[model samples]
Structures are given as structure tokens and as C-alpha cells.
Target: MLPHYAAPIWLKGGGHLQTIYPKVLALPSVCYRRELLSDSTQETVVAYDFIDAPQTHAPVVVLFHGLEGSSHSHYALTLMHMVKQKQWHGVVVHYRGCGGVVNQSHKAYHSGDSLECEWMLQQLRQRYPEQKLYVMGVSLGGNMLAKYLGEAQNLALADAAAVISAPLDLPMASVALEKGLSKKLYAPYFLRSLLPKATQERHQGKHPHLHWDHLLASNGLKDFDQHYTAPVHGFDNADSYYRLSSAKPVLRHIQIPTLIINAQNDPFLPPEALPTAAEVSACVTLYQPDHGGHVGFVSGPFPGNLQWLPQTVLTFFSEHA
Candidate 1:
């Protein structure tokens, strides 16, 4: 077994520090080649790639970012840089407007956009037919990809997969985030970006049924999902959306070698909500650390680095491949 992960002593603030460290301090300078790809809905999203010998049959790592996250996210940059160091190709696929491209579709991306996840993987599989393909998803993207794995395991879109800090149980996740620091700090952080685009889309007549006041008045993700996300995505309400979207229900169906790394203390998902070995197929491996909060897995000395998460994920992929 790999060595156990222990948060650096310098990160004394616990989950909060583990969660915010990389996002606030570990951002690095790197270059990427951007490509725009459209889905079945004709909505386009950009993929920022870190490439080395584009035509080589070397392995390819496709990453899916969290809600409102893009290629510029700390996790994306850190992982892609690591991929480059390994001389492997890596690409971060942005979800709709998250890439600053302002998606054309009237509907916004959701927590359970499994179809979109598979569509992107299919495209990547086609582009690199002979190359070994590995997939990694962070937070929201991780949950979506896990759902896709269970629903489309027969397709075998990837040789291996890794999910980081995903909230597999949406209902539980909703309640978790609406309380504590998740509500006070993270909610406003996400709302600043979500409210504006949703507000603009409402003004453009893309969301005619939603109350403008409610969308703008949303204090947390639950309220926003109820007002905008559920209705726009064709779900009856937030409750129904959460019930049908969570990956926990379908984890037993996964057939690919998959690693699910959800910190036991993740603010977004309570310890009780985590799936047990009985809840998953033999192909699924759980790595529930005592720390690492959300997608934050900082390690090293005084000023921690973002290498732990990427190294752990890549090591899993290498083993499976």
C-alpha cells in the first residue's frame, strides 16, 4: 500500500486550511493550448491542454473540474504540470460557461451531467485511439463522472479513473454545504460567480419561469438550485434532482478500476454519507483519508505544495494502466 496521507503540521486550521491552501496559495505559472469542443446540445466548452509530442501514443489524462472551476484552477494547473513532467498529455475540460466562454445553451451544467461527461470522454477516446486514457474528476465533476461510470461501464471509455473529494450523495451534500463555514464562506464565494451569469441568462429570456428575485436572492447553493438549476435542467425540484443525481446509488455497478478519494472530514460530505465497501463494486477502491478537505490536499514544508493529490491520483492510474 502507498504511504498514508497526513496533512502538514503548518496547516493547523484543519479542514478549512486543507480546503483553502491550494486555491489561495499554490497557484503556479503554466501554459496551455486551448481547444473548443461542442456537445450534443451544441454548447461549447474549452479544453486547456498541456501537451508534449501531441502525436505520440503516450498516455493521456482528461480532467473534469468542479462547479465554476476552469483550466486556471489550482488543481488543474498542478495536475497538468505534473502530467507534463511525466511527459504525458493532460487536458482540463471546462463545464460550459466556467471556461469564460459563456456557453450558448439555455440550460446550465448541473451536479449530475453524466451524459456530458461521457460525451467528452468519447471524443477524447476517438482522438487518441491507441493511447492509454485515464480520467480524473474534481468535486462536482467527480460526482458526475462516477455516475457515468456506473451508467456506462460497458462503454469502457477509460482505462482507469480517479475521483477527488466528490459529494456522492447530493442530498447529504446539500445539507452539509448549507451549514457551518460551507454556508458562510464557500456559499458566497460561489454565488458571486453563479448569480451574475444566471441573472444575465434570466434577462436574456433563457430562464423565463424562474423568479429573478429568488435567483438573485439565493444565499446558498440549495436555494440557487431550487430556483434555477433544477427547473432549467428539467428536474421537478432540488429534492428530486439530488435523489436521482447522486452517485452513491449506482457505485455498485461500476466495472472499471476506479479510485474514490473522499476525505472523512470533507465539509461538503459528512462521514456518515460515505459509501462502504458493500456499497461499491470490487472494481471500486476507497481512499478516505482523515483530512484533505474538499479538493485540498496540500503537503510539504512551511509553504505546502499541491503535489500530494496529483501524485496519488497519477500513481493509481499508473497502477491500473
Candidate 2:
């Protein structure tokens, strides 16, 4: 059966409203046990916060947050809350330099960097061999998860996976976020968080060759990626980075049961850029609802309910597990 999502009457049409509502609203607090893992580079360590279930042998779900997002992100906390309610173990992977600590290395996390994701999964599987493992990622994290799933086909990283609001087609999604009202709203917000971090990393001599002035002039994602992301990540340019990193082309190679959910009203991706049936493998299920802006899939009336996304994701994982 196809997944059906009905937006509340008061929150049906506007994408912006759907996207912004949850961020402004507050959910219950969740406590986590922090675990820091040293990276392969040896200089830096990434953090993972574990929310253990009450039962001893509960299923484990690994969560990947979006660009510049951490375990404290609204979606991360809300989903972790749901995982606890289901008596399942949940852990949120904090990309390098994102776990409230500046990474020792110059390289930061990006949408296409799946090596870290693969490493984290392998470590989790080794640590908890008795438990069933599942994975879910949001936005940029979703893209990385999809790429990892497709690339690591035969390896049993997790029992099943889900990707939400991912910008699968990076080039198109970049364009969508760069123009019109989206540029006016989203770009500035992202830059506010990203620029300072980039600057701080650079000041610590992470990228001595790149001109700090040039990178500092970048006012948006595209400019920032062109100047900082591509060069530091070993890409020829931003376009090449997008083409190589995009999850769309690799979707057909995925072997495990996976769910890909996107909202038609997502401000970050154009509807035309979404993949067709031919683009994905038989094991992949695509659920595109008419309304759930970006990472926001708010339902219920008035102030709204925060459980829709977590419920949908958990249901998919449960079915496959």
C-alpha cells in the first residue's frame, strides 16, 4: 500500500508555513548519553549521542542530521523521542565539527561524504551484534545515507533505511535554493551558521592555500561550495561535486529495502528534479506527499503535531525489520 499523508486543513497549501512551523514550536526534552568516536584521520573526533531504550535487546536506529545540523536539531530530537517511545535504541551521528566541538582537521562534512556514515554503521554493528539496526537521514544527511546504501550494496550495514527531504539532485536543488524567495529566506540563514564555522576552521590553518578573503566574500551556498567545499573536498568544481555526490544516479544500485520520502512542496528541490520509477532500484520505495515542506511533515490541527515524520519513518523501518 502507498503511504498517504493528509496535511491539516489549516496547514495545507503553504510550503513556507509547513517548513517553519515546527522550528518555532517546542517539543519535549530528551536526554542522551554522549559518545565521542575518533575519526580515521586521527586528528578529529565526531560525537554520537545515544538514547537507549528500556528493554535490553531493543532494535537500534542510527540517525543522520542535515547540513550544519546536530543531535539537538528539531527533527533529530523529535525522532529520538519517538524512538524512545517505541522502546528502541537511537543514536544521532554528529558530523565532524558539528558536535559542539571544532574538529582538529580542516575537512568538514558534506552531503556526499559517506565514508563517515559507513564507518559509524560498521562500528555500531560490531558493538551491538545482537540487535537489529536501521538508519534514517534528513536532507543533506539523507543524501549521504542514500549514497552509502547504493555504494555499499552487498554489505549488511543496516536492516533497512529511510531518507527524508533529501536533495537527491544536488545541482537542481542548489539552483532551487539560490533563486527567488528561497534565496531571500533560506540562504541567509544557512550562511549565518556556515560562514562563521568556515572562517573559524580556516583561521586555525585548516586551508592555508585558499585565500581567506575570497572565501569570506561568499554570501550563499553556491559561492561557498565553489570556493571552499569543492577545493577542500578534492572536487574539480562545484558542478562536478554535485554530479558525483548526487544520490539520484546511484539509487538504482541499492540492494536493501529503502524508503525515500520527499514533499512536493519542498522549498529546496524542484518537483521536476525528482526521480522517476526508472531511476531507483526495485527495493527502493518513493513516497512523495503533496505537502511536507523540506524536513517538515507537520500534521494535526492548529499549532500542529510533531509526530508525523517520526511515525512515518518508524513504520517503514518496522515493516522492513
Candidate 3:
């Protein structure tokens, strides 16, 4: 059964405030043992292990961070803190070219990059062969996780999975980001990192044939994808990239018990693109709450904390009855 979520009156001001609320709150600072791991392609990716969690026998909770997010992200810290309280192990796997380091490969991580997901989880699975392994992915990472689950079918990289704020339909989510308020708030946030990374890659003589003028002057993600991401990753254009990267089309193929949480109030995704029960397999559960803005689930009195999101995920993971 899905836990009911009610947005506290004080936290209510719609998705924008709820979404932005987590950034201001004083989240727990997890003492993480940073581990640098290499993928099958031999490209370096970072993983942060909760130093305090009992690694000997406890279940390992693996997290994949959102776009441009790292193990130090507010959500990561909060979730890992919760894991520590439960005496479970937690690890946040950073996407390539993320975690404050430019990766070695020419291509940056994308919404459909399931191979990396498989590699990282398998590596961890091998390390903790006797313990239960579970996984969650947030936002862009969530999308990639869903994609991986669908593509891998019953491969069982983890015992179960949860996805938070994943934009399953990449094209539709891109359109939602173009909405007036979303455009103003998020475009700058993403472009800030994306542009600089592309610039650094440019300095390394990558994407020399791309439209340098337009790429440098990119106004939003669409523009950035068109000029840089699409070409660099071998897609024809932004539309093609969006179309192929979406996980929506493959939901029915997933054979594991996967929970997908998409807050209806999230401004980053269009409600129309949300999948219905008929669209997914029996093992996939859709937990579409009416609140919790774009990965933000804040609840409490004066200065709120981000317990709802992590609690929701942990509850779903813990319930065996």
C-alpha cells in the first residue's frame, strides 16, 4: 500500500517552493568514504560509501544522483543519514563527468545510459554477495534506472528498485522545462555545468565539427542537446535524442518489483506523459502522489526538513507484508 502524503500548510505554495525548499534546509552531512571506480569502458566514476553504515551484513542501498548531482547532494546526504539510522549500508554512485570531476570519455551521461547502471550495481553486488541490495535513482538518474530495469528485464541487479522524480518521457519533460517558470529557474542551473563541461571538452579538441557558435550561445537544454549532446553522443538532433532516450516506451518489459514515484505537482514533468496501470508490467508499481515537488518532499513546522522523500522510499523498501 502507498503511504498517503499531505503537503503541510506552511510548506504549501506549490511545486516551486517545495522543490526549492530542500536546498535551504540543514540536511545531515554524511561522512562518506569516496571510492573511485571504473566502468567496463574503463572510464572513471565516483561512488561515496556511508562510512558509518555496517557493511558486513546489512542491506546496501545504492543511489544514483540526478543530473549534475553528486554524492554530496542534499538528497544523497539525507537518504544516507536515514540508512545509517537503520544500520544499513548506503552508496551514492556519481554519473560519469559528475562529482566535480570531468570523466575521461568523450560522452557525458544521459537519461538512457543503462550500461553504466548495470556495471556499477553488478560491481557492488559482487562485493556484497550475501547481503540484500536495493537501488533508487533520482530525477535524471531515476530515468536511467527505469530504462535499465526495462532493458535488463529480470537480470536482478538489485532486489527491488524505486525511482523518484524521473522524467520517463524525455521529450515531454524537456517540453515541461520550457514552461514559463521552469524555463527561468532550471535552465540556468543545468546550463551552468553543461556549458562549462562542453567548453572543457572543446578545449580538448572534442566536437570540433559541432556548431561552435550556436553551442556556445545555447539558451536552454534543448539548444544544448541539439548543438552538443546529440552530436557528441551520436544522435541526429535534439528530437531524436529525446525520443530514443525516454524510458516510457519500455515500462511493460520490466520484470522486477519497481516503484516509480512521480509527484503530480512536479513542474519538471508533464502529467500527460505519466503512465497508467495498463502501460506497465504487474511488478511495476506507480506511486503518483498529489504533492512533493520535483524530488522535493518537505513537511513540518517553521523550518521544514526533507524526510518525506527518503522516508517514503525506505518505507516502500522495508514493507514485506
Give the residue spans of candidate 3 off by over 4 A: 48-52
Candidate lDDT (C-alpha), each: 0.86, 0.87, 0.85
Candidate 2 lDDT over 239-299, as tens digits, reads 8899999989889999998999998999999889988788999999999988889888887
Tell me the tens digit of each residue's lDDT in model 1 across 130-229: 9899999999999999999999876759989998899999999999998987899799999999999987786667877787788789999999999888
User: Candidate 3: RMSD over Cα atoms?
Assistant: 1.6
- RMSD of candidates 1 onward, in order: 1.4, 1.2, 1.6
Question: In candidate 3, which residue pairs get closer than 3 Å at backbone N, Cα or C atoms, i.e. clash?
Answer: none
Specify the highest-TM-score model's number: 2
Instruction: Assess every candidate by TM-score.
Output: 0.96, 0.97, 0.96
Candidates 2 and 3 compared by lDDT, better number: 2
The candidate that wins on lDDT is: 2
Off by over 4 Å in 2: 1-3
Model 1 residue 33 CA deviation in Å: 0.5
